[model samples]
Target: MSNIFTEAEIAYLESQPLGRLATVGPGGRPHVAPVGVFYDPQADAVVVAGHAGSGFGGSRKFRDAQAHPEVAYVVDDLASLDPWQPRGIEIRGTAETFSDGGEELGARITGVMPFDAAWLRIRACRVLAWGIDGDSFELSARDVA
Candidate 1:
């Protein structure tokens, strides 16, 4: 498979520090949270971190991932200027949760999460990017990296 992100797409994604992460919850409900996100060019993944005791809902996202990895995350730029609108990204991928300490992935999350926060990181296994206006495209992690 090819990468889902282009040079411009990657740059755009990285430029945004906040995004709404969606995860399926009980009864197929969707839980969305605004999180600090970072894109790793080498890993070809988007990483999000949370505190160990953050909230039941946050942990639910991981459970949803374990139960069903199929997930979608949104990162968009919202502006109120001449452009009149902002661009956005919708990344669809298998979600994975890792808690082991000291690995590079863990460190990356630590860097982004609050100092007192424990880490629950979500790495984008696959990404599908689209423009809010209507244009859309998809890219695999490999290609994105």
Candidate 2:
């Protein structure tokens, strides 16, 4: 894996606890899920982990990724209400669904829910970040190579 995110972007991602993952569902519809977010530098990808039960390896987003392979993830926050500020990062990429990582990485992912280690790994093809490069709330876009 290659590093496509900047230091600031990585820091911002790791600091955030949740993200929205959008996957292609049945009939080409969009299915979005609120997920526990983690930036795994070792994997060089954004890892979305959530609860999985005995009957399934993961949730709907995982199934959709396995079927469609393309997905989008966004992590955002209201930096301030006093002055009305927002900051966020959006990643569009190819997604992979996997099980059996929980034992090793469960400690790393965020969220209060208990997870079975199943995760959706996103290999970013393009990334757009806002309010991260500096104090300015401008946007920065990049293509991962």
Give the TM-score of each candidate: 0.67, 0.85
Which lDDT values do the candidates have, in the order given? 0.59, 0.80
lDDT of 2: 0.80
Q: How many residue pairs clash in each candidate?
A: 5, 0
Clash pairs, candidate 1, are: 3-139, 3-143, 4-139, 4-140, 51-118
lDDT of 1 at 37: 58
TM-score between model 1 and native:
0.67
Best by TM-score: 2
- Where model 2 places Cα greater than 4 Å from the true spot, the runs are 51-58, 108-114, 135-137
User: Could you tell me the lDDT of residue 79 within candidate 2?
Assistant: 83
Top lDDT model: 2
